[model samples]
Target chain A: MTPEQEKEKEEKGEQEEQVLVLDAMKRYRNGEIWDFEDDMAVSDGHGGGENGVLLGLDGGTTSTVCICLPMVPSFSHSQLQSLPILARAVAGCSNHNSVGEIAARETLEQVMADALSKCGSKRSSVRAVCLAVSGVNHPTDQQRILNWLRDIFPSHVKLYVRNDAVAALASGTMGRLHGCVLIAGTGTIAYGFTEDGKEARAAGAGPVLGDWGSGYGIAAQALTAVVKAHDGRGPSTRLTNSILQALGLSSAEELIGWTYADPSWARIAALVPLVVSCAEAGDEVANKILLESVQELASSVKAVVERLGLSGQDGKDAFPLVMVGGVLEANRRWDIGKEVVNCISKYFPRVLPIRPKVEPAVGAAWLAWNFFMKECYS
Target chain B: MTPEQEKEKEEKGEQEEQVLVLDAMKRYRNGEIWDFEDDMAVSDGHGGGENGVLLGLDGGTTSTVCICLPMVPSFSHSQLQSLPILARAVAGCSNHNSVGEIAARETLEQVMADALSKCGSKRSSVRAVCLAVSGVNHPTDQQRILNWLRDIFPSHVKLYVRNDAVAALASGTMGRLHGCVLIAGTGTIAYGFTEDGKEARAAGAGPVLGDWGSGYGIAAQALTAVVKAHDGRGPSTRLTNSILQALGLSSAEELIGWTYADPSWARIAALVPLVVSCAEAGDEVANKILLESVQELASSVKAVVERLGLSGQDGKDAFPLVMVGGVLEANRRWDIGKEVVNCISKYFPRVLPIRPKVEPAVGAAWLAWNFFMKECYS
Candidate 1:
């Protein structure tokens, strides 16, 4: 084809994609098209389901999830589990550090919009919103997010903002903050809280800051091994062939091009499954990587627990240790999460491990309920 | 200022900068304004100096350099030292993997233009051109570059394309392609060639694929140590204070923002000197990082040497080991280069280390001379 024809074809393709996206957005906004939320709709008489909804956002480097829940004022912590999830929505990264402040804010706003719209609710129906997002290291970050959230909802709506790790902790503890949470997804971080509200954290500085237990870090080390083996700098391992074939590459040299072509942390982290598979197959190098990752992850939790005194003065006091994310959730024979718990148990014998039944976004919604109730009754 | 006014001011500043660059380009083309080349202009009687010139380019990730040398048909290899550099030019990155293909080509072309113009020479007077560039891993990369080089020069002019590591090796060997060369600047790679022309390379896959002997890798590890210390995961070290002050950061949390802010490997690699300083000051963490880097660097060289059989069956055959880049030239109290050499010497006792007096651009020029002469005489 001529250059003009090629240009025309490209433009047509772009236009079609844009139209499809717009149509999807329209259908999504009209959530009446989906029966998932409608089937779960309840008419509880305690001014819970129909009276109001809570928006809980867990914004991370990989993706942002918003969970809309009925604002049920549970008298006991166990009752919180029964709260119906009114609507759920997902979007791309909302971490201010990864995506700039404007983009991050837009993502948070759009996800909240989608959740509320899906539940056939509006901003006016939102009783409270808790945005627990990654990259919220400072009070300034918290206040900035809160200020923008104020712009989205009415002044009467209650707002609570915390680091995304807080939501992960709350997820396993049924909204109680007095526990430790170890998240090992594309990145890793350990955060802990005491009964009296004191808090401490370890890791969570991203891959460059040496969160080696993270999926990104584990996969990167695996890739490095492939390179070293091909170049004769390291012992030839099964990983070279395993990773090369998984990536549809013929040689280890091509891995370099494949890596930098798109330096997204998630893309590399996606290879964590293959690493696990290799380790399960008894590849020494892959097993070593997983073992090292477990140690690194346990160290993060230990650091947080020791600092926050979660295991008490005698170090035998029982404390809930929330395990979250893909790396931790791997239940294969070479289970990274099980190994991490075992490692942690050596230091804190009373470490009570909990794998949350719900996701972190629901934990955020629970936090919204807790914060709103405390303000109203206390 | 208002947004519109601020944009206008920014546009105005950009225009001024563009004008200055254009003016500099004009002055560069009118290289007669400088007298460095004029003072060395010799009219030798053998159609050597006044007859023609050779162009050599060393294109790297950080920068690209072009060297212009008089085409002297020297009888002996020792006579190559007497050849005077006619002109020299520098430009930004020309690695197509780092930059796009068009931008890399433009930079190469412009730098060549600058060198020829500075030496009061034209394409017609060029006897040969040798381009030694980074990211030339495949034969396809070499062919693409050669095709473009062909478009620029006359059919009579001979051209050669090679990986940037070849120029580095040639630099220490004085244009010979035998023995091993190890470069550990922002990245690390060991490349070797046998007397019979069998060549091999190790590492140079970059930081992701484990060039941990690199300046970038050393610095990144140091940063990780600081984060570990701050988060209570590792032992306390002097690197925390030293690196934080060097980077003008207030806290460990700030280091995360500082790191991903730019994400340029060179920017992170710049911290290598600080890490060395910390090691010299008796910081154990810093010392360990350097020691590991030493082993990594030495391993790359050993891999290349053993693969090429630079050491004969007795394992004591003499071979030139070319050491290049800032990491090797540190000359610090805790010398990394010295340690690497010491490590490699245990395996190959007759390893002769040579630090090149001339830059790689000159080596590229020497390569041009070698290529041109061989074709004419053979």
Candidate 2:
């Protein structure tokens, strides 16, 4: 053989050896995971539970939740609000961006198994599954997740996958995907959908790429203001005293240490309430931060609505605007959600605001029912 | 013993055991590190080479540099610009915030040792050492590093510690501390000192705390603009095309994935050139970003100058404005450093902008000389 060919062969052999070791490890793990199924009685591929069951999962950076609901044949679409939940299981961090793909997949699978075990249902008894996960940005992400689900379920079972924002929107609209949903928790994103299946999103890129309307963003700005004030770059405000006392820090310089000690976005976001309190107490800097945040949040919703044409061409159309997350749930004297709603109303006069009565997991379960019905009955 | 007392004793025992293990490991590592010193012949805590030597170290997030200079007793302060550098050594990150305290200390110690060893000098032969490192925000940070130096060198070796910005300032002023220094690289900060030893600083807080003039900040805003334009939240610009092309991304959506794949500030900051390119090509969005960054950079310098009274009571007195870092040395048609100088000149028209002829490590060495002379001959 030529020297180059010989080298290629040697490298190929080493790669094959590595792949074999990885495959063996995976098989062992899969065997241990599926051991619980061996105890079940053998039956046809049909469901064991009455009318079977539907699985819905809402996976996020902080936690993954799987909800089990009965696929009652008699229930109509109008009764989505009354759908009874069979079981729910919770697990930690299923966002592939936060945790690696392998760990995220394992967490998702375990959560689904836990939910099924709680409801005394097997995989054959699952009729449909809808997974709404945080990291599902591209079609590739959705297809990869669908492939994983296909491996674990019978081919006859229906499956759907979407970004977690879809679940939030569905929760507010009772499974009808035709409006904009704004989520402003530790991070922020605005997602919208049309009834005919077109969808768009804005500002879910996390803190680095500038989701400035988020809880983390607002708190970070407040901290910056405190630093600016202490360093004589900006006007002094009550935030210096209030934030320092709240954190039990002696000076603004300590904030740098406190911020970088742990890079968790949620830890910094927890200071949002203090910012609100300061704004309510007439701190101009804090007030300005909140006002800017309101504008930012409104802009996100407006962007989505404008992109999806949820607002009609003339801009006078009634569309549900689902508002979720801690930043919006602030029912304070200086209500952020209220201000955002008002700001958007100037551009969209008929914008109907919604606060989801059910959690996102319930929305995912309803989505499973809806997607299954469409595929089977179309 | 009581149950609580027994529990406390057990916990204390575990803590002691852990400390002992860590201590033994540290001692072994330290022994390995200083083994070269043991091979050297013992010398008096005085001159080994002619007039001995002085060591200066500039420790930063990216890299650490140590410069060794011969101590010349006859050289006048006016001839400081021609100080001889005996040796130079380089090391990786020595910032305590980026690398842990132990690792940062080891890097600093190793670099200094390497510099001394290269020049055939010992710690005993060292006159004074000035370590100007990043992450030295508080007096406590300074004290902790000073304590580390105390353990490394003999008591007679006069040691000085300051923020890395001080070295940059001294570099432009030829070791004089009476000037303002503005550093705008991956991060940005403005530090100023008066002749009477009064000092002030502004905007040294990292990107989270709003160092908006920083390379990281400018690049992040550019990325944000791309996302906004893609999502229809902001005006479409050349940045969307320029940044995506630079990153080899197929679309703006891919930018999110590329960004979160690695959380390194410098990695993102590297995109500053692309933003600059787009702006120079007449992209309004990119132009606006640059303008805002210029204002932010100028604000920091103004804040420091005003606080330290470096511009005098009328804010028109001449003071050396030392400019350093890649952001300032753009040398392009759309020069960010030139704009910053122009902006600051409006308030202090006589602001003398100086780009340092020597690197910061050499400035640290000069600082060591000045500090040593003041202490010994005062």
| Chain B only, TM-score of each candidate | 0.86, 0.89
**Superposed Cα deviation of residue B134, candidate 2 (Å):** 2.4
The DockQ-derived docking category for candidate 2 is acceptable
TM-score of 1: 0.85
Residues A92-171 of candidate 1: C-alpha lDDT, one tens digit per residue: 99999878997897788888877876777766667999999988878898999889888777898899999999999999
Give the residue spans of candidate 1 off by over 4 A.
A1-53, A71-74, A89-93, A96-127, A151-156, A376-378, B1-47, B50-52, B98-110, B113-125
Model 2: how far is A112 from its true place, Å?
Answer: 3.9
Winning candidate number (lDDT): 2
Give the top-scoring candidate (TM-score): 2
- Give the per-residue lDDT of model 2 (tens digit) for A42-100: 55322335678998899998899999888865678889788778889999999987799
Docking class of 1: acceptable
Runs of candidate 2 exceeding 4 Å displacement: A1-50, A72-75, A97-106, A113-125, B1-50, B97-106, B116-125, B140-156
